[model samples]
Target chain A: MIEHIFPVHPAAIFILGALVIPLLKGRLKQIYLVTLPVVAFVNLLYLPHSVFWVHHIGGFELIFGRVDSMSLPFGYIFIIMAFLGALYAIHLKGSGEHVAAFILVGASLGAVFAGDYISLYLFLAMMTFSSAPLIFYRRRKSATGAGFRYIMFHLFGGSLLLAGIVLHYTFTGHTHFGPLESGGLYFYLVMIGFLVKAAVPPFHAWLSDAYPEGTATGSVFLSAFTTKVGVYVLIRAFAGADILIWLGAIMAVYGVVYAVIENDGRRLLAYHIISQVGYMVAGVGMGTQMAINGAIAHAFCHILYKALLFMGPGAVLYVTGKEKLTELGGLYKTMPITLILFMVGGLSISAVPLFNGFVSKSMIVAAAGLQGEAAVYILLVLASVGTFLHTCLKLPYYTFFARDAGIEAQEPPRNMLMSMGITAFLCLFIGIYPAILYNILPYPVDFVPYTIEKVVEKIALLSFTFLGFWLLKDKIAGQPTISLDTDWFYRKAGTAFMWFCRNPALAFAGWVDMTFARLAGGFLWFCRNPASALATGVDSMFAFVVRIFVGRQRHSPLRALKSVVGWMDRLSLAAEEAAKRRAQREKMAALAQGEVDVRGIDSALFLVALMLALFLLYLAVKYLW
Target chain B: MRYLNNSEKKRIVRYRKHLFYLGLLLLALLEIFIPRDPYFWFDGLPVFYSVFGLLGCILTIIICKTLGRYWLMKSEDYYEE
Candidate 1:
């Protein structure tokens, strides 16, 4: 067991640090922001390799510090990413974005270390809400809408997870978080919840919809955490599930297919996130030791390169204020360093030799081959070809090197470049020496990535893919259009829901309100002159009955009833007059002026009497029955 | 913008295409010499990756573009409208 140097949870470092951000300003805030992640990283290094910090609440264990091989890799990368993301956003003046990002990072770390379902659920929910501001901070109309949709999707996924956790506890009577027993509703519910976060298709549209809409620095942080945490939880609970294999394979191809015609530069990269995550998901599904290592390594490598990828486009958006490829070109002349750094990320994602993706991605693909799953192997490789076609070649070709759009731009801030440079260096370092990453994986590593045959094969494959792109490059250029995905269903449904609320729902509510208003109005009228109103109502009823029997005769029962009602009305009026006269005679002018409105008093008393008699009648009917 | 003059840029662009073709040929040559360690039936086939990569790239573009053109692609304001 590793000796512990710090007993405090790593997540507490960021969560507590976020609170201090509002108090500092200028360079102090920047220094403090950069220090938080570094401090957390140092703290994570010495955490004991066992589940410590266990506490009990209502007879259920809530483990806040579960540091083993599986959680450690994720912890390391998340903090490293937080460091890079903080450095990237160091130039921002506002504190809200910084606070949100820190809390999100903290929450992700919390989820990573959670050893029970309840803590995991809490962290997962915090992750959903905390990350939303990253998108909302863009403050564009599209960003606001996309942020709302993003939250809705995550909330839905969170609810599913919560329900699953509750059901699992009910069934098993424990809240321990680990590999779940399969073949239950909770199992599928939990898998789907994780799948939604992983951006597995059908549940995937939220990622592509919202990610590109985030602020430049915000998207970098957004790209690093949410789905990767989804991958983390899946690694913990649903490894070796057979369905994920095929789903991952299809998802690998599905993303690249959408990316092929994607116009938004950031949206294109977002699609590749889905494609790349497919490899990790497939690795987890394979459930072999090497495969799991591949998934972890890929996740670690992917976060670095993917952040770099997002940073490249983000820098472009930051400087030029454009994100669509249709509106950009020839930036390589002005932003050459950004181009070069971006290429490192693109090449890494393409899994070219001497980049991190090569070291990690091949293991998953090779796992498929070793397992004799031919279809999975082919689909993943095909997706890699598409990844190269779009991310490495097509994206850069158009955005940086194609026909000059004559858009004026410059290199982004110094901190942004520094962040990208550090990430690019790590991508190359991991690719050149896989052993560093391998040594930290949960299981022992047995895979070798740099054999001559594999290198030669990859080079040949990617080169030929380049040749094909050279031949058909014009056909795949970004059009000024958007490609529909599964989000179309919900976006359209959202519109329909709004229409329902505006038209049918509003109409129904108005009708109900009008009905209640009419009833209340009638009751108010009755209260104003109860004696006269009651006499008139009784007269009308008797007149109707008499008309049916005697046909409006002068001496009919209706005439007699009307005369009796008139007498009752007159008697009430006489009483009101007599009370007024008595008050006047007593020289109680104050009572006459304010305290006693004789007619009002009489009507109110009559109304009370009628109600009491009705109540008695109701009581008699109810009790006698 | 000051990094390279127009003439130097033209010269590089002129040579880059040939370099790409040369790189492709060199890669194909390297594959022929590399020792085989076949993991599947298709892996044993010579130049399988090259053919797969090229055809896969073209087919993916064709299918996806067709899907976009016929069904998926929409105006930029599709959701808003």
Candidate 2:
């Protein structure tokens, strides 16, 4: 059992830090930026491993910030990610964005270490919100668009997560995120909300688009913390669920296929991140000892190796100002170290025997196969093929080893390369010796990552796939092309939305806005008229300002008033004639959808005057009428 | 908008060739029902699996010919241009 940790929390520190980063003056600003992350990192470490602290509001209690065995791996890794991300962003010219990046990473650190659901929600939301700056770090058109898309997706996810949480609380009244003891749509919706952020397919566009568009170090932070924490949440809360196995399998294939077809090297790596996450989700979904261990161990290895892969291409961008593989070539001569490190990252992702991916990926594969999920198994195999095709073979082949583009690019700064080199080294170390990771997993280590049959099968499979690449390498070289995905919905369909908004042919909102403003003026004038008593019955008359004028409605109000007035005048003129017609009284019962009174003109005028006075008084208070 | 970019057009032409070879390969793979494997399908096909592929070539060509004329198919730096 992990020991209990700190109880109460100080809310001001996070809020104040967010405030100062934007307000802090020059020269000393970077120092505070760096200080913020270090403070959050060490603060997380100070908490004991097993603790439950509770917060109460309105006689309601929420126990969170409970340190447990599960949060340990993710917590430590997140802190380390923060430290590394801070270091990477320190050299960035845009100090403001760098500060935001650190704050985002700090919040991610807070999120993983939180002991309860509400605390987790607050911190993770901070992580979600703070990531906007990273998306806009480059301040380009693409970056802005990506940032907006990211926010849209997260906001949608947030609403779902909130709904699920509220429903769960209504059902269970407890916030402890342990294994399932309850069943219903509420819990599943909550899990799916987390799944969206985990970059599972259909909700994965923002991750692919935003991560690549950020500053080099921003992507590094992106890789290390955000989605891995999402996977961690799944493992901790829904570790006993069954559907995730299939869901994860789908994610695995979805990611790799899209990655293989991607042209932007950074974006390609982003897609792989999604693919690898699928494996972890499947493992967690398997709801077994070996599978959970596989997901946790794989997540650890993935965080390191994927970061390494991004670093190579990120370094290239830092020095060369290019990210697409089409323009990059023959960097092995200058960036041989990057090439080597990237090769390690690639091999690990491809799960070649004696690499990190093979060890962790194998565990999930074995777990799924043991459960007799043949479809998942086949997809997993095909995914592995796709992973090699893109990440291992394609990424390096196009970036460093393809036809020499004679672009005179060179190795990155020693520090950046050093960060990458470390990740790559660990990938190999873990691959060859899986026990190191297994020993530290949340549960007991029983699964053997390396076995005679396993090694042979993995080698045979990856090697054959590599051979396929070699034979067809000529067909797959030196051209940047777009890969289709859900983004087509947004990129194509979203623009279609803008077109709809702009179109004058249909239900025209712009025209309505214009017409509404004009009609509002008319309504204001009518309210000032002497019709307050008669109009008092129709609340919609006052509420009518909220809506734009319809084609029929435009003329109806004045026409009604005119016809009624006309009736009153005729009534006075025909009074004598009425006396004669009384014997022949044509008492026809009035049948109409709306009420119109001819004789209430004086009362209507008075009512309009009274309404106008009230309106002016309200507008005076509100200031915007 | 006037004509598809040469590079894009080349991608389509390549996909068309791939589709043809892919279809032949699938037919050959299906021929595994034969008693003695003449290996003719395996022997004849170059390097393709099937027409188990979609119309990237068709869509790309159509997009270039039709939508390209009116859609926002401009230079990469369309705003600057």
Candidate 3:
């Protein structure tokens, strides 16, 4: 192991840096924000290639830093992305978003380097909570709702992870964060937790649901971290599970199919995140050294190009306040730089020759071929074709090159363009020199990517896809519509749940309230003049009995009984009237003394008696048992 | 400032379709000369990638559009109402 030259956890730099952001302003804040990532990256370079920062508490170890081949690449790219994201958001005046974003970056790094389950769970939870404000930063109604859903989904996933951790610890008595034994409840629970955050379908709706609702600058950061972190943890823990292979393949094509019909520009890109991460997931499932490297490298290249892709639409949204492709057109005339940079990202993601995606994504596809998984190879290739069709062809055609929509727009801010430019440069650089990326992989790299056969195959595939697009260009244009996905179930279910609460649950509560009120009213009336009421009731009973005995005799012996009953009833009536007058006088006196209603005292006393009875029953049961 | 001037833009617009077709032809020609080591059984066929690309693209479009029209696509406020 390399000796420790830098022992400070990189997450510390970011988390502590976040505290200082609210105190700075103007260019100083920008400089400070940009410097924090740079400092963390430099520190990462010197971090010892071993587990450090281990602490034990309550018979459990919590490791804050675990730097090695497996995690180094992720650590490097995260810091780099933090820099790009910070630069992209440099012009914003608010400090809350900046702070939240910083904390999110720190939490992601914390997760990447965590060597124990406790720290990992903590960082993951922090990442979820911190990243949510970026969605909420949009401050729109849709964004607020989406943010709530986003947190709910992540918290659920986090709970599963926590439960799995607890169970694993109970089973094995260790909290070491490493590969898990398969075919157990904990294994599936942990895998599902990662899958949910990874945006694998059925668990994927939160991404496309919430991402498009983020602020323009915020979405750029949103694109980089959450799912990629999910991918990272999956890589670290569950590399060779067979189920992930088919799930990844399905997820790859799944995103493409949905993206084909999507109309929102950012939402469409969000779907592609699912698609791109699918490639990494499939690679991890392959369990070959080449496949794992490909997964890592693809993740690295994807973060750059994907962020650039988001930056393109984000820039457009920044300038024009529109995110729907149906609402944008002919922007190339005014935003040529944005268009060109966007296409670079577009081409890279499509895996055109000599772009970052070409260099990395091919590794996974080739790994599948080497493993003789013909079906998976074909599925991945087909998904690539779909990727090119929508991201490269459909999106740009509708947003930039189609008939003019007569919307006024111009280039975005300088910092935004600069960030996009730097990201585009990196994508190209990695595409040209795969060695830099290869050298950082967790394992030795020997595969070549620029072989002539591969080049020809990709070129021909993309070229003819263009032909297909030319043929059906009009049919695939963005519509003023939304395509349903798995979120449809939850969104509709949420609505149904609210309806149940509003109608049935609320009606039951109202009925209970009314019954209690009626009971109390009857009891209060009885309490008001109990003596008079009892006397009057007895008099009526006596009169009825006498009448039943001597029915049709006007002046029979029943007349005396009837007179006695009548006199009692009159006496009781007079007594009731006097009691009412006395109560009225007492109420007036109480009012003069600034007191409230005394009638409520009766109900309070009845409630106390009910509680006493319940307590007595509880004591009887406890003692008898 | 625009990346393409008016004349350049008009010129590209006029010849863009021709250029695309030319690109397709050139790619097909390159496939003939490039020595092939097929990874899959079907990849051994002549111009297999071109056919796959074309057919795959068309099929994906047809399948996704059909799904969208019949089931997936809904009104903008499908959730709200």
Candidate 4:
């Protein structure tokens, strides 16, 4: 009887519930949407720490829910964010957005709990397919273009990941999720795949390009899942790989450098997500228990705070339809709650004391210091300062407190404010009481974040950073401009490739085909005119015979034979030409008869009769054979 | 302009000055009292974080601005052309 209660996977709630979402109407739809994540959140708590819902196909075991310390924190934050994301998007009028967000959240949860590479790859692809619609659903030209690019990038990354899994399975003769041994193409392929999603430098431009193009609430949903899942997989597979430490350090600073020049409010925040994920990637690279814990903790905190940050500007965009930082200003006067909430998010991301980022980000920075990597430590610190400069100071200053653009707009809907409030409260709660989050970490909580020296040091760093911003505010004011990133290659190259295919490439292909066709046509003409060649050969042979027999007689019989052969050849050639012309005329007549206009049950009946006759013929052939 | 009174507008105008003085005072207090446990010798210096934060932001802004101006920044429809 106890076993009759099937194990409830958290992902099942969202994955299955998404289908029913379209059936719901109006307020019921909203209620159902909010409840799905709540159910998933509740289910995640009771999920056993061992793999459950195991099914075997052939010799392979498919483990759907692998709940342990490592996955739980990611899963916990994912479902929480899903609930908050749903609430934020509750005012959206369309069901398509809600459906995509559900599938995205569900697929991400499935990925984290996926105990095998097959399940992981499945969920990863699902995540990609579902998330693209969130971007494309906006239906704007830029959004649609960005959505295609986003999916294409992920498809490339997914192919690499799938290739890696196949190689790993072939080499190891099993498909299980665990720490991978270093040595082969599979390892590097898988690592690069994760890095693409993790938004490591050079491959990092997709997040900034696509995230801002999503619908305001859609970006909130998007910010939580895709990159963090990449980080989660990194922790699971490539911990202590050594290369991530450098790649992550580069990603940390690279994202901030881009964010500094960005004029789009959400795009700047998107870049900061790259910067923040870099901390997680670096922590995973450290491969120590404390560092891994730090990565996980930071992933959790970054999701909530990042979503809150997106929500702030999302609310603004929802009301005023402005996304460029240069176009928005003095919104704080009307939207004070959004200002305070956004500040909370900004502070959290900047790692201020009494915010979540401090509690988590400190662990990675401290781990670097303890690991004695001075260069990485310094770079991470610099990135922190940059984070404060752009996200905490520049973005809010320009969008909320800069000289008024004189466009007055009200605060966003209540659900958005409520979601922000919940996220803000969580950020504070985690910062003030780090133990709540620390206790749930994969490693034991041994680090303290609130030492007087640490607090004072953070204060000094942030305070001075604020001073720098204050001094440089005028000089650093946003312009109506877009900053180029690595996506420039694909965006330009993709366009160039399309042009090549349309014009030059097509023309070249046509020329090659025409040349080949001409060469083939010469051979075909010789083959078709065989009667002339035969007649010439026969006439020459007859003349030779007559010369041998008649010995130079004036009227040899060979001449008459040659004339007869020539006449027969001409007749055959004329007949053949006439047949060819007739065939061409027949073809034209058939074409002039136009398409067969079959409609209604007659076509269906004909198809059915053809299938029946073919089946009968197949039976006879099979029996006779 | 829509929501702020005259005093509120004046206070908002003075935000930069207040942030400057407050930031300077905090740095001074940290330099005087904070313990030194540097990961490296440079970090051991008093008010290392302040200098790091200030210098890092400036260098990042300058370098990013330069890069953005010469290479990264483009007209909004750059990709379209």
Per-residue lDDT of model 1, residues A1-625, tens digit only: 3453545788999999999999999989999999989888878877879998897655678898888999999999999999999999999999999999999999999999999999999899899889999998998889989998999999899899889999999999998999998988999888889999999988999999999999999999999999999999999998898888998999999999999989999999999999999999998999888888899999999999999999999999999999888889999989999999999999999999999999999999999999898999999999999999999999999999899999998999999999999999999999999899999999988889999999999999998998899899999999999988999888899999878866667556655755686699899999999999999999999999988988755688888999899999999999997676555444533333353354785699699889978986886676556
Cα lDDT of model 4 overall?
Answer: 0.88
Instruction: Please report how far candidate 2 places residue A536 from its true position, in Å.
Output: 28
DockQ for candidate 1: 0.77
Candidate 1 on B1-81: residue-level lDDT in tens? Answer: 369999998889889988988887887777777788888988768888888889999999999999999999999988887
Model 3 misplaced regions, further than 4 Å: A1-5, A518-625, B1-16
Angstrom error at residue A571, model 2: 33
- Model 2 chain B TM at 0.36
Model 4's CAPRI class is medium
Best by DockQ: 3
Better of 1 and 3 by TM-score: 1
The TM-score leader among the candidates is: 1
Report the lDDT tens digits of candidate 4 across residue range A1-625.
5545555778888888898888889899888888888877767766778878776654567788888999999989999999999999998777899989999988998999999988899899899989999998878989988998998999999999999999999999988988999989999889888888888887888899999999988999999999999999999999998989998888899889889888999999999999999999999999999899999999999998999999999999999999898899998889899999999999999999999999999999999999998999999999999999998899899888888999879988898998999999999999999999998998797899998888888888888887777777887888788988889899889988877765666556555755686699877876788788678768999999988987764478998788789999999999997686556555644553465464654689688889978986886676546
Model 2's alpha-carbon lDDT is 0.70
Runs with alpha carbons beyond 4 Å of true place in candidate 4: A1-6, A508-625, B1-23
Q: Report how far off residue A562 is in candidate 1 (Å).
A: 22
RMSD of each: 12.8, 15.5, 9.7, 8.6
Docking class of 3: medium
Query: Per-candidate TM vs. native?
Result: 0.88, 0.70, 0.86, 0.84
Point out the higher-scoring one by lDDT: 1 or 4.
1
Candidate 4 chain A weakest lDDT stretch, 10 residues = A589-598
Write candidate 2's Cα lDDT for A1-625 as tens digits: 2345443232234445666665666557656755765676566656666555565633345554556667766665665555555545555555566657656755765676565666677777777878887777777978878887887778888778778777877888876666655478778778877887788877787788789988787888787777888898888788857778888888887776566456689988998899899999998888798888888888888887888888888888988898888898888888888888888888888888888888888888877777777778767766777777778887898888888878777787766776676677778888888887787677887777666545544554555465456656655553445555576577776777655644443334434544686698778877786476457646677567545454345367887898789999999878975564433322211222135574596589689889978885875666533
Error of 2 at A320 (Å): 1.0
